[model samples]
Target: MRACHALLAATLAVAVLLVPVGAATTAGAPAVQQTPTPQVDDGAPPDRPVEVLTLADDDANRSATRETTLDVGPAVGAATDAAGHELRTIRALARVRGADDPDAALSREFDRIGARAAGLGRQQRSALQAFADGEADARTTLLVLARVDRAARALENRRERVVTTARGEGATVPSERSVALARELGVYTGPVRSQVAAALSGAEPPARVYVSTTPRGVTLAALTESGYVRETYRGDLRRVDDASLTRSAARDAVAAAYPSLWRVRSAVDVDPARVSTVRMTYDGGELAATVGSRNRRVFRDAHRQSLGVAGTDRQAVNTRDGFRLVVNRSYAGGPMRIQLRTVDGDPVAADLTIGPEGGESSPVGTTGPDGERWLLTPDERFTLVAIRGNTVVFITMDPLAAPRTERP
Candidate 1:
């Protein structure tokens, strides 16, 4: 009997020891945990709603302006008015194109005027250089310089009018100034015009980028819905709108923000949406997502995955007008905290998910009264996708690098 009792006691001890080891081993496995909601006093003020500024009107105005100025619509009809000014050298140069050429007369005139303009440009350069170098006195050389300047201005005006005419008539000119200069240098050729035309036609319009300098860094806003979030990276923030110019500016802004940390691998224009979808990859796998948008935003992840995920399969419906979701994924790899609030700091309720980076996420059971959730993940590294109404935020967390903070 004493032997049997001793053996039973030994077995119990071994089981207890084995239990702890299994628990510890499974601690990092993906799981979901709910945080208890604190009792609210009836007298406490109701949570103030967050305000998302309306952007539709302003965006429409910008879109119209961009289309009219940048879109290659119908070929501009020939100028109704004749060339506004005549050059003294108009009769000097012979036509490069034969009479059989459709634009023989215009070509001849352009060459003559171009030659005079080039000579004037050379003279102007010399005069400007001499004055800059203190070789010519500001006062003593005033009269001689004035006459030369007047003649040059007259020639340039004539050249401008001719160039305008060429553009109106849908003719290819090297440039506002290049054609004239090239002709004077005897470098004008049929191919030059063709090349110039091709370039002008294919050239992308300037990107409209609005840069607001912040204390930490700069905010590159793209004026697109995707660029509505306010997050920090290398002290800089980013968001976007549409137009070829804005797209380029967004790309340039990201490159400038954290050149050592992130890079824009590609930016493709979505003509239908008039916005650009950009891919920003980082130097290290330390960050999961690096881009933020109006509906959804991703943070810099520890595991470098492309910014923004593919498809909307897991997207959360956002609240139309409420607090913007701010996520602190500073926890090295898995799990992060999410808070819904306005730029001014009002908290609101939201639904959220915590999961492994690029894997199925576990739902962080309903938010507490404080509009906060303790996003839990099984893996050390994870992503949190939060949704409140219509807004969504995807956050990548690195628990290893997460700031050490005491949990209350």
Candidate 2:
């Protein structure tokens, strides 16, 4: 009986091991295998993957990777983590060499700072991604982005000084790869910072953000409920203020830029909190204008003329002296091409100026053997005077007047 009890006890222990903890068995029912549910950290949702876009170093060379989607967080994290490792390695190298090696020390220092800046850039991109994904709020994201911008700008200035010192000492300058890596960080951060600033200033946050990298820098298009808002950042970390022109000031600037246009009307409702794109109505059509912050006095028109004959327009004037002047006007205040030819269509080289005879005039330059000269058109009403060795011909150009077609 004691032997039997020992065997029974052994069997019970085996049963206990087979059954899972916290599992209950019902009498007269077959045992069921219970698979344990996997536990998630902090009970948070699973990771949502996002596609991050990167621009190639050469803008003209297009590659499949240009459109390839990547998980931004992991990609950026890996890059920054690698930079950090590089920094540590650089520091170790610096420590090995004695203090007497100033050149080596300076080179290592330059590399270290570049790595640090790249790490900060990684943080900035992560913050922007979080804000875009609704994982973080605007205020927190903006603060982080602004801090990174300021830090990066300071580092840029510091790097310039280091370059100067390295040149003076005849030491090695920072490697081009390292410099490019640091600048690449700015390319990603600058545009996002601008978007965040716009959002903080009461512009609606974009529903979806699309990024494209270019040779110059980066362009970001934010899709909102209203429409797509596009902005380009060339990696210049300077602070940009919102458009500050009053209605009257904006109108005056446009008028001055297109003085030849009669009844030039300003239709732009200036927004103090955002960059305003100035739109003006003229007698015949409407055009867009961009005002510069440094010189609010000047306005640049946004219209462009096509070079192809399908949509190109031209104005022709005939002189009694058997000369024909063809004006290919560009957008107002843009490059206007003047072609001078004889009545028989022979190209003629002639000197051209802005004003009519005996008026305040400026030289527009001489035409080439092909009888074509491109120059900037004045904003006001002006006469294009062409002189070819005492054979003088002039025509008044008014942008407000519609172009008159000449029969060939």
Quick one: best TM-score, which candidate? Answer: 2
Tens-place lDDT per residue, model 2, 42-131, is 211112101111122234211100111233443354346446655654444444344455467566666666676768856755664454
Instruction: List model 1 lDDT by residue over 25-75, tens digit each.
Output: 346642322212212122111121111111111111110001111223211
Task: Assess the local accuracy of residue 207 in candidate 2 as a C-alpha lDDT between 0 and 100.
Answer: 28
- Name the top lDDT candidate: 2
lDDT of 1 at 353: 69
What residue pairs clash in candidate 2, if any at all?
A: none
lDDT (CA) per prediction: 0.31, 0.42
In candidate 2, position 276 carries an lDDT of: 29
How accurate locally is residue 332 in candidate 2, as Cα lDDT from 0 to 100? 21
> In model 1, which runs have C-alpha deviations exceeding 4 angstroms?
1-104, 132-135, 140-149, 163-408
Q: Which ten residues in a row have the lowest lDDT in candidate 1?
A: 9-18
